[model samples]
Target: MEYTKLTLGIALLVAFAWILFRNSKRSGVLHALIRIDTIVGMIAGLYLVITAVHSLFF
Candidate 1:
């Protein structure tokens, strides 16, 4: 379960980075992808922080 979460987090991070650096042209699809990527990145970041805090305390 932990490894699965870690893998997903890494994959999301890579996808977010790819989307971020891919292009500057803003098409509709690009805009949507950027939004999705941003959300995924935020979720991944929050998951990591929560996991860290949980581990540290309990």
Candidate 2:
């Protein structure tokens, strides 16, 4: 479970970076991809934080 969560987080982080770095170079499909990636990254960050805290405290 932990490994899965970490992998997901890493994937999202990479997606987020790609979206961010590519924004000025492309649009249309790339823009859509960026939006999706940003949302997924936010969710993954939240999940990772929550899980980490839960594990630390409980």
Candidate number with greatest TM-score:
2
Local accuracy of candidate 1 as per-residue lDDT tens digits, 1-58: 5556656666666666666555334555566556765767857855865675565567
For every model shown, the clashing-pair count is 0, 0
What residue runs in model 2 are displaced by over 4 Å at the alpha carbon?
Answer: 25-43, 46-58
After TM-score superposition, the amount by which residue 10's alpha carbon in candidate 2 deviates from its true location, in angstroms, is 0.3
Candidate 1 minimal-lDDT segment of 10 residues: 20-29
CA RMSD of all predictions? 4.6, 4.3
Identify the candidate with maximal lDDT. Answer: 2
Q: lDDT tens digits, residues 11-31, model 2?
A: 666766677666735665556
Model 2 TM-score, all chains together: 0.49
